[model samples]
Each structure stands twice: as structure tokens, then as C-alpha cells.
Target: MASLWSKISAVLPLNEERFPLQFGDRVESSVVEMLKRSRRQLYSDSPSASRTLNAQVILDISWERLNTGTWRHVDKEWRRVYSYGCLFKVAALCRENPSEDEILQAVRTCDMSFLMGAAIMENILQDVVQILQSEIRKSAKDEDDSEHAEVKRIKIASPHVPVIKDQLAVPRIKCPSLESFNTNYLLPLKPVILEGIIDHWPALNKHSWSIEYLRTVAGCRTVPVEVGSRYTDEDWSQTLLTVNEFIDRYILCKDGGKCPGYLAQHQLFDQIPELKEDIRLPDYCCLGEGDEDDITVNAWFGPGGTVSPLHQDPQQNFLAQVVGSKYIRLYSPEDSDKLYPHQSPLLHNTSQVEVENPDAERFPEFAEAPYLECLLRPGDVLFIPVRHWHYVRSLELSFSVSFWWS
Candidate 1:
């Protein structure tokens, strides 16, 4: 409920003159300008005729980092926010030239700079913690002051029923339906290990995809670009051309290196043509539904160089691995006692804890948090309910797919 600006300022040492926390059009404009400048290639290379049409789809997503006011409207707010690297992927292309699948794949795959953004945010949190320490030290001598006395008060509720580590270790079983899962595990906000749900999906089966098939389905395929002379860098792009072109560029073509196994070309819906129409699960009577219908196909393409920091999804989700391997680290929603999610509507309000080396002094509750380690190989899908915190690491240039529905 406290403001991010105030909370961050309390912990980090900062001068109002240097880093003023203000929200207005100027800040929004700055973000717009930042995105525009970053898309230099897209403007220059993309065909001039379709530039306006293409730009229309570039929705002005009002994220807290870009617009503080938009964040304020959300119930939850987080301190220490910063964004680094390219926010969205863009590439150069000639006019009148139809956008190629390679271009689109490159754009999707290249939006990986979010990892760099995470590190920048951590620095901001460090500054906040330092400020809090200084304030505490100053109040140590003022015992009689009510403000000082209140600051000294610490709330440490005891756990009446200690949860055994072994008990928590047992993997959960998948319910017969989403309604059962919600009634059994969600209403109370408890975490459970799900089994068999992912094992039954066709995509998670033991079938190896062809080079051509993987490119069409994976969404983020890269195109090769020429280097000095011997080799060229990859020129990423996207277009809805025939599947044959996809295989030609990403599957069949070889650079100075070989393609990764998980990066194969595969079509998930080809096997289940009915899926293409229902790529995203539509609303069903039994399962509770969210406001939006756009909850079907949510996929992530983290190639050799991307990592999703510890964060949670807004809705219940089923993460199915189509190709490649990803090391998944998950924290349950109730563990929010430790992860510290923002009470905001801006879906991705995450805690500022550095998972690699959590500071016990700053986030003491993390000590009580339980974590689960699972490696998602091809065909293994992990079920993550809303608000469950998790982090992902691409083990070997992975390609993973997920299906989400309301």
C-alpha cells in the first residue's frame, strides 16, 4: 500500500534533485522516445509502405516502469524499478518486401534484454536497503519517541504447525479438472505438486520434431547474417510465409555452427488440427474465467542468452515444454510471505529479492520459503497457478511452449 517512490527513498540514499520521482506525460514521452530510438532498424529497414500498419500493432503497454501513474492505478506497487536493454525486438527490412518469418522470429527471440533489466532493478533495491539501515541507526537513541518506538517493534508470528521438509517434497497430483484444482489448492492459496497433467499432452510426448516444423511452431527463429567475410551475424525477422521457408532458413541452413536439438522445427497443431482453432483454451462453464479471452497460447523463446528472473504469472498456467531443456525454479504463491509481491494490478509485480544470494537481513522471511527444482525437458509441462513465483534458466539454447486458458 505504501508508495514505491517513498519506500525506495527510505531505503536507498538519493537526492530529490538528482532522481526525482515524478509521474506525467514527460515520463511517458521519455519511455516512448526510448522505445522509438531502440527501433532504429525497424524504421529504416522495414518497407516504408507498411510502416504505419506495422506500427499500429505496437500497443502502448502502460507498465509501471514506463508510466508511474499507470502503476498507481494498480492495487500493488513495487519499489526499485529500472529497465535495461531492448524492451521489444525489432529489425531492419527493405520496403515493399514482405516481412519474412525469420524477421518475426528474430524480433520475438531478441526481446531477451529483460534479464539485463532485472540486474538494473536490483541495484535500485540495494540503494533502498542502505537508506533503511541509516534511518534505523539514527532512531536507536530516541526510545521515548512514539515514532522511534514503533520503528523498533518487530512482528514474528510463530508457526503453530511446522511443515515437514519431507512432506513438502512430495510432488503434487494433477486434478481431473481446473475446477477441482481451484477448489482443492487455489482458494486457500496453498501449493501442491502436480503430476500426470503435463505427461498427457501430445507436445510433451517422445516425438522428435523435424527442422521445418520447429521453426513454424517455436515462433522465434533466427536468420543468419554475414560477418566480416567468413561468417555473418544472424539477421532476425518474421513473416507468415510457407512452412518450407522456415525450415530453409533455420533448420536446413547451417552457419559456422550446428543448430541446437531443442531448436528443431515442429508443428504442435499439425497433429491436433483442432488445436489451431483453440490455441488458447476458451471459457468453460466448470472452470472460473478471467476477464479476457486472450489466454490461450503463451510461449517463451529464451535462446542461448536469456534468463527470466524470479517472477509470477497473473493467471493459472500450464507450461509445456515443446523442445529444449530449461531449469525451472519455483516458489509457491503462499510463499508470497517471502517473495513480497506488489499489491498492484500490473500483473508482473515481483519481489526485489536476488534469488542467487538472498539477503537474510533485508528479506528475513525468505528463510522460511520452500523452493522446488525441476528440469523441463521436451514434453514436460509444469503447472503454475496464479501468483506462484518462479525463475527460468535456458539450459542449452532451449525452446519451450506453454498453454494458458481461462
Candidate 2:
């Protein structure tokens, strides 16, 4: 087996040759020049002693700008700066004959979303993340000894949850042919519960995703977790935490007084490419009529009772339940008037009326909208048409992956 450093050490040099002193972009010429200087110092024996600190300062400033203020999906120049920061830190650490712990720690602590489409930086993250994954899997050898499985079905946090029954329910179909799905579901813009799909995922059988397994693999990795019950709540806020910290505090919390924490709507796959290997992007995602670049994959992991108050996405969605269950309610785009959408530009896609417990006095029209509901279980996928108003509530400790394509 080749070592991570042996495999990826040449990537930085190639990247340097490819992107030497790009000065005409929005990033100041001085900033690009600083990166060039840092790369040169990286070749020196004592890069960590001085250049690393300077790199960190620039990293902090770029990181602050990237995170604070209005959040945009893309900030080309800032992301490049952030990637430069990560590259410099890792290169310095690797050059110093640092332990594997040091390299893993550096990868976990830094934001993984570097410059988009930059294969050079991805090489840096991919090598470290994959190595950590294999190490964690190797540590689970004892658990797999008797069962012929990597992870046994450990008891989930939630009690046996009754499936939500509905008169108007989403259609359930087993792995329909691509042409059939395009005609019956895609072109018609209808929702369906697709069964017999994703049953063969390695994450389900070969690796078997469980709490203990996820913790072992990514416990130290930091992720943004929502600190309140739901995003619509006045007290709603987000904070950064490691997977272990989130699991202990949120998923296993017994105190009724504490607010629920949700690791919701995060591109966790990009951060932990290890998780991306466990599952496959469904072929149905290709059925969307939008550009291939429009597709976005996100992870939604959290405890029971976490709610996504009536909201609609701009793209078609395939919500796949990996562990535990969820109850989903969806209404057509025609019911937009009844949904009482928030007027603010930031939350304009979200609805003001709560789907389950609507205030009849305030939002009278919401009561009249007929909606289809479904109980999304493990190994199941739910198709949600673009602009369809939907509300989601976790029925138990859950790990779900959603693919959104226009």
C-alpha cells in the first residue's frame, strides 16, 4: 500500500507550476505574491518556524471574510485564499516529519471547502480523509469478527416510532426504469417513494453505518450544527462542533430543557470524502432537466423531533434515508398562496405557516391546502419536485443524504 505522502507529495509542485502568481484576479496581487513566497519557503527546511505563521494570519483573515456577512454559495477569490492557507499548513506539517496524528488534526481542524474545482487542494483533503477512514475501519475489526458485518444494528436513540398515516400519500414504486421514471415522475413533476433502490449501497452492507462507526471515523472532524429546534425559531442559531461533541450533546441528550441540535443542510461529503465513498449518487439525479453543475448533495443528520419548518427548495430533490426514519409532508406549487411564505429575501423560500400545527386564526388559507405525506424509512428515497412546499421532522436519531438537482 502506498503512503498518503508518497501518493500526494508531488501534487503541490504541480499546482505551483500550474498557478504561478495569478495577479489579475479579484484577490490582490500582494496576496498572490504572499502565496508564491509561502510556497517557496515550503521548500526550505524551517518552513513551519516562520512561513507557516504568516500563512496562518492570511488564512484567518480570508476565513473570516468567507464565513461572516452575507453567505454566498460561491466566492471564487476568497476560497482560493482559504485553499492556499490549508495547502501551506499541510505542506509545512508534512515537511517537518510530523506524525499521522498531526496531519489528521490539521485536516480536521481546517474548513474542507476549499477552492471549487481545484483538484490540487482536493488531492490534499482526499488523501488525509481516506487514510483516516481506513484507519477507523481497521479499528472496528473486533466488532465485525462474529457477525460478518462491520457494524451491528445498535439501538437508536428514539423509541419505536409509529409511521405517519395519510389519506393523500406519496406514490411508492420499486426501482422503476429510467425511461418510465422520467415519464411518470420527472416529466409529470410528481413525488414518489422509490423502493428497492439504494438497497445495495456498501454503506448499508459492507460498512454498515451506525453511531459508533461514524464517531470512530469522524468524531474529531468539526461540522456546523444548528443549535436550536428549527431554523425558523427566534432562538435558532448555528455553532461549530466536532462529531463526537455533537453526538454526546445532541443525539443522546436526555434533558428536556436543552434545545435540539441538528447537523442539517451541510455538504458533509465534500468535507469527509470518506463518507462519499459509502454511498452512491442515484442515477435518477441525472434525470433532472438542469445543467449537471446544478446538482448539490448534502447530509442531514440529527436527533428525533428536529424539524424543517415548511420550506421549499429551488431544485428537485431526492431525499434518501440512511438510518432511522422521518415524516415528510409536501404540497404542490399551486398551494404557494396557502403556505404563507416569509417575505424576507433570506428566508423567502421558507413558509411562515407551520405544516403540522398551523395557526388557524392567523393563517386561515394554510388549513385548506391539501398535501401528500410519507414516512421515509432506511433504504428508501423520496422524490420532491422543485418548488414543492415540504416540511420534515426526524422520527428518530437519523442520518439522511439529499441530492438536489434543478
Candidate 3:
């Protein structure tokens, strides 16, 4: 029943005298030397050396004694150094105005034993390193350019999206039969654009899904909306808002500078059953080995300039443009290595290189990657095979429904 601070204090004592705070190369060197000498004393069992191996001796060690050793000796020191270093670092962090929640999290999760060996110590070190790196990055300035006007210098060149010379264009057809679509496109893993396919959907009619009509149908229904220009941006966030609020803030407003609010990838039909009557699942989805109920129907509604970064999905998709237009660029699975996918877990499926504005210097291989581009209009259904990299940008205030099936 101890408080969080008390738990932290038990693990990492707050007494300034016991854990004297120090940092940088001096402290690192001292800790390394202390571990080396401790090992030597353990093997030698010299009485004089044993007497000198107290806390004070450990603190006042010289870097000359910290020499390289065998793998066995090196591994031991690595554990001791990390365990001892992390304790001091966390103690220092507590004094530096860290939030109570941060302190509580560390206390609850961290293994506090000074005797913990290399494995546990290594894990703790990884966590501490991440925390420190985040803090350092936050404190760093965005731009390093100097203010003095001794000479005018050209800025770093803006990114340029290269055109592919032999890009494989996705085939487009007008109202192809269900049997032809399955045999020609679905079975062969070929992408196709079906024109005049969703003309029968009620959403295509302006009166059915106008701002006023949307508000009347689902105004009070809470929906998760993404408030940002793009999810790749740092300032992007999601919040729950009413359909009416979304219409007012994003659909009706004329502020060009504000970030767009997008209601994307949500199952609106499930939330409001009335919306299910607006669209129908194409028979092409039935060609796969799943029932009609297995299909995931989601909506994407946003203003112009909204972007969906380059990413791949696990299921085949039919992106049907109900209102307005969108520009789409797709890269084949074979060119994945050339795309420079993000290393972070949160965005592993997304490409690090921007398609609209690519940095040639950092991602030079991207220039060699060929991609198909198209502008989708109302009643157009673009088929996206699973794992095909696609990036989308709204060319105008657009509303689209995507159907994904295995």
C-alpha cells in the first residue's frame, strides 16, 4: 500500500549522500575502471587491493586502469556499468522535474536489484537510453542556421518526385461484368479502375450526402476524426467529435491555413445502419474465400490537401470515390527495398521517403522505383492488391468508401 514515490525511493534511494550524482566521460570512465579493478581484486585476492576496493576507491579511480579485457571480463563489466549508470541517471532525472507518472512507471517496471546481471541490466539500459534520447531531441533546435549576414547562402534544395519512364499503368474499364472482373483482375493480382461501377449508390447523388443531409442523418453520432494535414506529421492527433462539429470545422470552414480534419477508416455503416443502404459490396470481393460479412467497409471523408502517406494493407481493397476526386500513386511490391520504409515500429509499413516531395540525397534509390499514378473521380473504384504500396491525396473535398476483403 506504499505510494509511488515511496516505491521509487525504496528501489532507488533518494539520499544525495548515498548516490552522488555525476555524468559525462569522467563518471563513465570511473565506473568502468571500478568494475575492472573489482574483477582483478576478485581473482588476485590481494589484501591491500581488497581494502582499497571501497566506495571511495571506486569513485576516485583513474581511466588508465580501464583497459580492454577478454569477453568474459568485458561482459561482467558491461552489466555492472549499465546497472550502476542507470541508477544514477534515474536519480538525476527525478531531480530534473519529471512527472509523477513517469516516476511511477519506472518504479513499477524496473528491476531495482544492484545484483541484476547483464541481461536485466541491458534491458534497463535500453529503456533509460530511449528516455534520455527523447529528452535530448526535444531540447534540440529544429534549424541550425546562423543569424549573421556575412554571406548569403542557398537553402537545402527541396525534394522532387521523379516520373517513372515505364510505369505500369493500372487498367481502367467501364462497368465490367462481375465474372470478367474476378477472372481478369482478382485472380491475376492486377490492379484495375472500375468506372461507372458505383453509379447506383445513393451517396453519388448530391442531395443524399450533402453537408446538410449528413448533419441531419448522423449529426449527434460521435466519430473519431483525425485532426491534422497528414498522420506522418508530429502534430497529428485523433479526437472524438459529432458529425455536425466535423462538418462545421472542416467541411464548411474556408480557412486555408488550418489543418484538415478527416474521418477515415471508420465503420460508419455499423455505427449508423442508415448509411449501409448508401453503398453495395461488389461481387468481385466474393471471388476470394470469405463470406460477404467478412468484408470491412470503411469511410474516408476529408477536405483537399489531406494526405494518406505511402503504406500497404493486408487485404485487397476497393477504394470507391463517392464525391469529389483524389490523386493516387502506387508502387509495386518488388520495389519495396527501394522505397526506404520507416524503421520505427509505429510506422514500419509506411515509407520514410515522401512521394510528392522526395529527398533524392537521402533516398537515392527511390528515383529508380517505378510507380503508377492516377486521378480518381466520382463513381470510380480503384482496386488495390494486398501489400501494394499506395499514397493518396485529396484533389478536392472528397468522400470515399473503401471495401477490404481477403
Task: Estimate every model's Cα lDDT from 0 to 1.
Answer: 0.42, 0.74, 0.64
Candidates in order: C-alpha RMSD to true structure: 23.3, 4.2, 18.0
Clash totals, every prediction: 35, 0, 0
Q: Whose lDDT is higher: candidate 1's or candidate 3's? A: 3
Weakest ten-residue segment in model 2 by summed lDDT:
147-156
| lDDT for each residue of candidate 2 in 63-169, tens digit (9 for 90 to 100) | 78687666665466676677667767765555555565766566563545432213344456556445545544554434335322322322433445655565788
lDDT of 1: 0.42
**In model 2, what lDDT does residue 349 have?**
90
Query: Which sequence of candidate numbers ranks them by TM-score, best first?
Result: 2, 3, 1
Candidate 3 weakest ten by summed lDDT: 148-157
Residue 384, model 3, lDDT: 96
Prediction 3 TM-score vs. true: 0.58
- The TM-score of candidate 1 is 0.42
lDDT of 3 at 398: 78
Winner by TM-score between candidate 3 and candidate 2:
2
For model 1, the run of ten residues with the poorest summed lDDT: 224-233
Give the TM-scores of the predictions, in the order they appear.
0.42, 0.84, 0.58
